[model samples]
Target: MSDFWLDLGFRANPYAVRALAPTADGRRLLVGRDDELAALTKRVRNSDLHPVLEGQNGVGKTSLVAVAAYVMSQDFKEGRSQQLFLPLGEPLQMKDDGSELIRDVYFAIAQAFIAHHDDLRAAGRRVPRVDDLETWLNAPTYRSSKGGGVSTPLGGGYATTGTGLNTGSAFTDSGFQTMLRRALQEAFPGNSGGFVGTLDNLELLDTSSSARRVLEEIRDPVLQLPGLRWVLCGARGIARSLANTPRLNGVLADPVDLLPVERRYIESLIDARVHVFSVDESGRANTPVNADGFGYIYDVSNENLRDTFGYAQDFALDHDPAFFLDSSPAEIENSLMAWVDNLAEKSARDVRLQGRMWRLLEDLATAGGTAAPGDHDAYGFNDRTHMRKNVVELERFDLAISSRDEVDGRRRSISLTSKGWLVHFAKKRDLLGQGALDLSMTNESPEV
Candidate 1:
């Protein structure tokens, strides 16, 4: 069968929003992050401090990092300054002794060094000490049984082999750090550029003291290195958790928050993506897909870039492409709401938090989708602790948005997100018939 994306006239699956692939060209299809990108670029160029990027899921934290890396690489190409952005393959897993985490970090840096050298050589530039760096990075190293015994060559004839080197001992060796630094310097070959290590999904780090201590030990000294900058990205909850750790006081700079893009920017994003996939008989690019379909998607997705692309892609696959060109707004909206309803119903079945979620949604609906923090008491949550936990859960699931009330200025409130409202309305209408409590006053959608 033909692939759905190809059938829809896309050159590639434009909605394939994985962590920006490492080898991908940095010219990403991004939208509405100009200010954030500028600030990130400045931080990377001007400081060696480890900065944290915090945001809700799907707010494009990974994309932001990719663009920043691309910009820094451009700077190097254009003779601005030298700072190679080396993103880790994945976020470090929180471990008990920190040995595994450190080992992974070391391996990722080594791989980046190798890639940079390969790139330089491919461009006909002289990369001095390339042989020495490859030898060191590929040297047989001990690995714990848990580390597995997979060996893979990471380009340029260098292969990382698991030769039974003790994971803890290898990192503890006094000369490892020095050797790694020397190899990095050799690869870059001048004081012009340094290395920026981009680590995403740091919210995975365990909250255990042992884990944090290990993180601090491995992280703090690296920040002091004149040529290296570490950028950690994760959700806001993790940022708050890390902020309270006494040992991490000065090690972490203020976090850069990636907020939601405006509605206009989201519309532009849809247009941009549609243009990428649309083509004429001459094989030239053409106008975007139906504006009505795009607007309906924008409204349903609440202006989230990830969801906008996802719904648009799904809409294309579910109906004939011809229908999409002149789609009805009502038809598209109804289809989107149905998709959202199914998603919400499945999500609400989470065994751990189902009861609390239903109750919280009920309260939000009763309050017209917005309620002060103190409103939980009227909903059978007697104390702030219980209410706060449920609110956190709601935020984690993207079901509720907690923000300061604009009218009241100083008071914080919790409100149903678009998805949340859909699910709440469905339950009130007895569509799901899950026997959920109906605390709402009317069937009308909330003012939000």
Candidate 2:
């Protein structure tokens, strides 16, 4: 007889960060950031300036903003709010004249309201779906095949190309607003406090003059519409660029900056991610691991790499053997060796590393680096210009840094705390460490 055994303890690390799961359990996945989420919900309830979220990258700004849109869709049902999620990239490409963006936004809004009607119908509520109620609410307005003129739901009205009302069944660039107001009122019936919610990433569609104009025109008025609320997600660059535009200056106003998720808040977000990835019906872990692994790798690497480098270089010239013999050198060597060994081990495990890498890259990209004022909005790195775009993409993960290799060979850099990194990676990678990771610096070579 032959005995065979496999070391189950060793699983090849995928080496690639997990592809973002599309849903949480059987439902849409919503992770981390209760306060930020609540703040956005509050913004939906009160603010008119349009809730704007800005972060260095990989901070889950887009996802958070999207979650806000979904929340409004679910919470404000009675408000008859329509969630219009428009990616700026697609719209800008189709409608170079800016007419396409406006029409698309209106169409998207109308569809949202229409879906709201369907939801009501699904619940056995008597309210007519937009299709059935079109006689009174006017459904044909935005159905224009002409690709010109603004016509809204009310039918038989005239409007500009991008902004107009629906005149029955044809598309025209006119009279869209009149129909919209009536439709909204009809949907809400003048007192129930219904709303129309529009979520757009303005930076995607309009990075140029025409695009910006379209955004301002579409978003400005939407911001002020009585029961219509807009939560727009955009790069900080886009927002800054739009700041001085005459028309948008006041109408869109200054957006409430959706800052990066703070450590505590991110902890909460990681918890949510845990719940989302949970194997249970409630989608929550009974004992959540403290942090995401990839995020941990990135953060720990960043911290130890920077700190170790700094310590080594800082005292390199000093060569204080007493320090290493005492607390500093031993710590430095231990920390560096541990991180370096961990990275190698992680690579060996084929652990999905994007999130961690992104975290590290993002921190590096954003921490104290200077770019030409013109280069700020760009997403990638320019090695010649001392920039890395990979970090930008990773910044979406909100882990990045800025550094300079100084003349003294000391690299000035920034990093996240191990605890912070742990939580981040755990949430992002959807895996918790089997046991607490020892962070203390020691003289032994790091062994996984």
Candidate 3:
């Protein structure tokens, strides 16, 4: 037999988690977020505003921000604009005193600034580091009241004790703002525009009072500064929770929701990766392994791009290059079931309240995959609050999808995704060895 896999194009597994879809030279690889990119670019260029990007986990919010940064960098290189892209890596954990949170944000920004300069120098660009900027960012900002006197230093370096500023209260100081403005000018010589600061995973702030307060304070005053734009990325839950915060009402523009890619695009994405290994000897290309199974995989994936890629990877793994040419339908189904089983096992391990979650899933499956809010009591939930918490947990795991509707009155309906249903049923029949419960009359209202 010929070395079929060797003749293919990819050097490694194209469907690996770290694999990114290829883009044209000098462009960023971001699929299915054109509208969001345009809105972010315009907002950054035209206004001093804070924009929130909201989406589900694995829906590509970070990718969108990275693409925006790439475009901004390209514009800067070509002299179209002088917008600096400062990416704040992750959200600050909530603190009771709020001092640590503020200090961390500033420290993260400083580090990103330094890292950006490093990249520029590595690329052979002639950009000089400003002494004042380095001094301000490297100095210690605050001291903790603990016995050891922990100090908050900028950019991972300690500063002289007497020279440090108190970060807890220094954020609003005019002197700090002046130094920052001058620093920007020194950092980017010809750039008239200011900096764009991107904070990914902003949802982490929602559960912390201190973090939220810091964010609110920063949102109002920081945007008022010339040329600075803050883009916050998080889930829709954070946006809704912050919607009514008085301080943030007018300061933050409407959030840009990153919706899922269209079904066709998702199929094309799978095909693109598979096509890399589908070439035949005659230079003619054939469908990669198990093209017929894609539809079933897509259905199981619920059209989520990341999940689709995962299923494709599972298919590829099962049909090894040397052994099998393509996976049969039975093999594909077995692979999918195994994937679902693995998800359930992982979920069970990660979730602290695994017992409650399993019960909820069991109840959901017993209810013909759908359950109304009023049916919580029937599912052995102690109260509506417990049920709500379990729903959030399930949603977090992407095992359940909920929607609000007005049938007689406004009520929320919850249903298990295909994976959820499969896992629940599989556990009942195979894993846990529990017999299946009848679900035919699940639509009828249970007696209170």
Candidate 4:
């Protein structure tokens, strides 16, 4: 197919499915996050505790952190702030294996050193010795079998266990860990703050106890490092469980809960990106999804910015260019809504959920798309077993998903899948058309 974005006067697709990078252009494209940016900047700069960003999946937590770090670097560059904090290119994915996590993180740090070498030099920061890092990183014998102790590039046979590194060094922390700290010290000099790095996707661990265990494992090796300020991002209840963990006390700050961007700002958000990615800065650009249409999709996606963007792009591309180029804004919105309606109908057929399963889906949507398994009672479910049977049916159809946490002795966490939300919203719109819906009786459609 021909490129539709160019026909719309954009240099690129504004709704591309990627988080905003920590760059000048990315900052401009980021909108409606000023308050969040400011609060995050403060937490990064002044607080000793690592800031945790807690939100639903794809609510732009990564974007918020990246932009905040970029802005801080700008402030420092312009002499408005006292320190420079280089943002790593991407958040480190929290790992289950201790050695692997340490090795991978140090490699990332080594790369950051080279990537920001110029900035460090300009700021009178000492760029750490790259030769050593390069040699070690490129060494043939970086590791051995999982059970064996870690091997060194120098071939000194360095190994690490729960206790610490065992080699020539008597240090509890490994030589690799020591090297990482020293590199950070060289980059920032004295008390200039440090690299603003993020450890993301704690929820992928699936259970709160595992999350806590992994975090505690890295506490001394990574989190306690002096020259790295951390922002931890998580979805589900991982942040909540970590917040309550006694082992992480004084280490992690109370999470900054990130709610979805209000639909009121949709236009501004689109306009900002449209201008940024336009073929000409002053030229008119076509954004096919009107605010109402985009808002509807955004709501149905449970305010997941990533999925919402994906849907918008897919919808735009699924149709011909003339559909957008020849249509009025109102006409375009109607078509988009119809497209989503067709999707919902297809999902309804695909799931083919029974009445009880549908009832459970509705309760989940009503619970803001996430609730405890115990919440089944409130949804008129007879008991956990009855709820489980229905939820399993929903899961089997890919309509609902659940997670368990070691916290509170296995908290039953369940959430509606994207399809489930679409199914729920489909029912909602139908009821609204019939004038039978009671809650969220606003003239505007509600976020289910």
Top-scoring candidate (lDDT): 4
What TM-score does structure 4 among the candidates reach?
0.86
lDDT of each: 0.56, 0.40, 0.52, 0.75
Q: How many residue pairs clash per model?
A: 5, 85, 0, 0
| Per-residue lDDT of candidate 3, residues 1-448 (tens digit) | 5344453344445555442321232132354567777887777676545777766555666566656766776676677765554443444343444445545655555555565666555434333344444665655653322224332222112322223354555543413434444444455445344455655565444342433576666653354544355677765245544544677776677777777665556545545555443344233332333444555554444444555557666655655463343544566456656655665444333323255566677677665555656667777766666677778878875768764322211122466765565465445534432222223213433322
**Candidate 4: where is the Cα deviation over 4 Å?**
131-174, 409-412, 429-448
Per-residue error for 333 in candidate 2, Å, reads 21
Q: Model 4 lDDT vs. the true structure?
A: 0.75
TM-score of 1: 0.70
lDDT of 1 by residue, 351-371 (tens): 233565666767776755555
The better-scoring model by lDDT among 2 and 4 is 4
lDDT by residue (tens digit), candidate 4, 219-313:
88788877788899987657877875788999999987899998789888887878888898794788877567778899889888888998999
Rank ordering of all candidates by TM-score, starting from the highest? 4, 1, 3, 2
The list of candidate 2 runs beyond 4 A from truth reads: 1-32, 69-97, 118-129, 132-170, 173-178, 188-199, 205-211, 219-226, 263-271, 277-279, 282-292, 297-448
Ranking by lDDT: 4, 1, 3, 2
Q: Pick the candidate with the highest TM-score.
A: 4
